[model samples]
Target: MSGFLEGARCSECMDWGEKRNTIASIAAGILFFTGWWIIIDAAVIYPNMEEFNHSYHACGVIATIAFLMINAVSNGQVRGDSYSEGCLGQTGARIWLFIGFMLAFGSLIASMWILFGGYVAKEKPIVYPGIAVFFQNAFIFFGGLVFKFGRTEDLWQ
Candidate 1:
């Protein structure tokens, strides 16, 4: 009975482990898509400078770039296990990852600044644009994080 129960438990764990990568990928993709979708909706609904400034889209663009940067380096490259030929090797990967994180954070902060400074602080605040900007950055940032750290690197092998 003990062995049977242990075997069942191990199988269950293995099943979940096998599915983890798919689950994480789906979640990250959903978050990224939803973020872009929200921004698109906001832009279409308020296509005028008076309602939504085109400048605000820059934050989402930066965040998208950051997302790509963050995911470009694999865990092994960052950890010095599978990469060691570049000018800086693992150190370079680490630095690139750091810069990516900085960009992500910077974009997110900029979005919040836009939200409060451009909309919330105004006398007659129009909030949808600001909220949309903030959520877009937030979702993209989180999605990048999920894609970067939520999966098992071993699964790729």
Candidate 2:
């Protein structure tokens, strides 16, 4: 009975590990897709420039760029284990990661600023566009985090 239980528990652990990777990937993808979808919906609903300023899209664009930058460097490369040939090497990876994070944070903050300053503070307070912008940046930032740190790097190797 003891041996059987042990075997079953081990198998369960393995299954869970495999499932975790899939779950993380799916969650990240959903978040990213939903973020974009919301922004697109907002744009469609408020096509006029007066209703929804097109310039606000720049925040989402910057956030997307940050997401790409954050995921471009693998865990091994950042840790100096699997990458060392480049001129800057691990340090470069670290710097790049730092810059990515900074951009992500900056984008999120800017979205909040737009929400408050552009919409909430206005006399009429038309809020759908501002809310959409804020949520888009928030979802993208969180999705990037999930994609970066939620999965086990060892499993991929």
Candidate 3:
């Protein structure tokens, strides 16, 4: 028995959970910055091009606000726990989270709409602006997900 149980688990042993969180967080940060770089590149690459629409940038703003809101609420509140019940309550917190997701997804959908309806429909079919907006929203969404769920085994967890 002594030989079999010679040693117990050690504090120096690798913590897989922490490792996963660190990797996911770093990847999410890279994606976030890459997306921003795409947006900036589009604006700078063809500065003299008058075909680019100025209003497309608004989608980024909307997504940013949603990102902020999503991060503002505590995870406990989102899960509808007792602690979160004190401030906004379970229902309120859920509602707030819902609104945040809607805004985030809406930004994504809006980018597509602008691409198809505004550009494609008009037969101009510009690639830079449309793709930039879509990538921005997508990366933000992915980054938010990674930030929010990286610590957990799964999203719902």
User: Candidate 3, residues 30-89: lDDT per residue as tens digits?
Assistant: 877777788888877756445667778888888878877776777776776544365668
lDDT per residue as tens, model 2, 15-100: 98988989999999999889999999999999988878999999999999999999989888888888354567888999999999
User: Which window of 10 residues has the lowest lDDT sum in candidate 2?
Assistant: 79-88
Candidate 2 residue 105 Cα shift, in angstroms, is 0.4
What stretches of model 1 exceed 4 Å from their correct place? 1-4, 83-88
**In candidate 1, which residue pairs get closer than 3 Å at backbone N, Cα or C atoms, i.e. clash?**
none
TM-score of candidate 1 relative to the true fold: 0.93
What lDDT score belongs to each candidate, Candidate 1 first? 0.93, 0.93, 0.74
- Per-residue lDDT of 129 in model 3: 75
TM-score, cand. 3 vs. native: 0.77
TM-score of each: 0.93, 0.92, 0.77
Tens digit of per-residue lDDT, candidate 1, span 55-153: 999999999999999999898888788835566788899999999999999999999999999988884356898899999999999999999999989
Alpha-carbon shift of residue 62 in model 1 (angstroms): 0.3
For model 2, how big is the CA root-mean-square deviation? 1.6
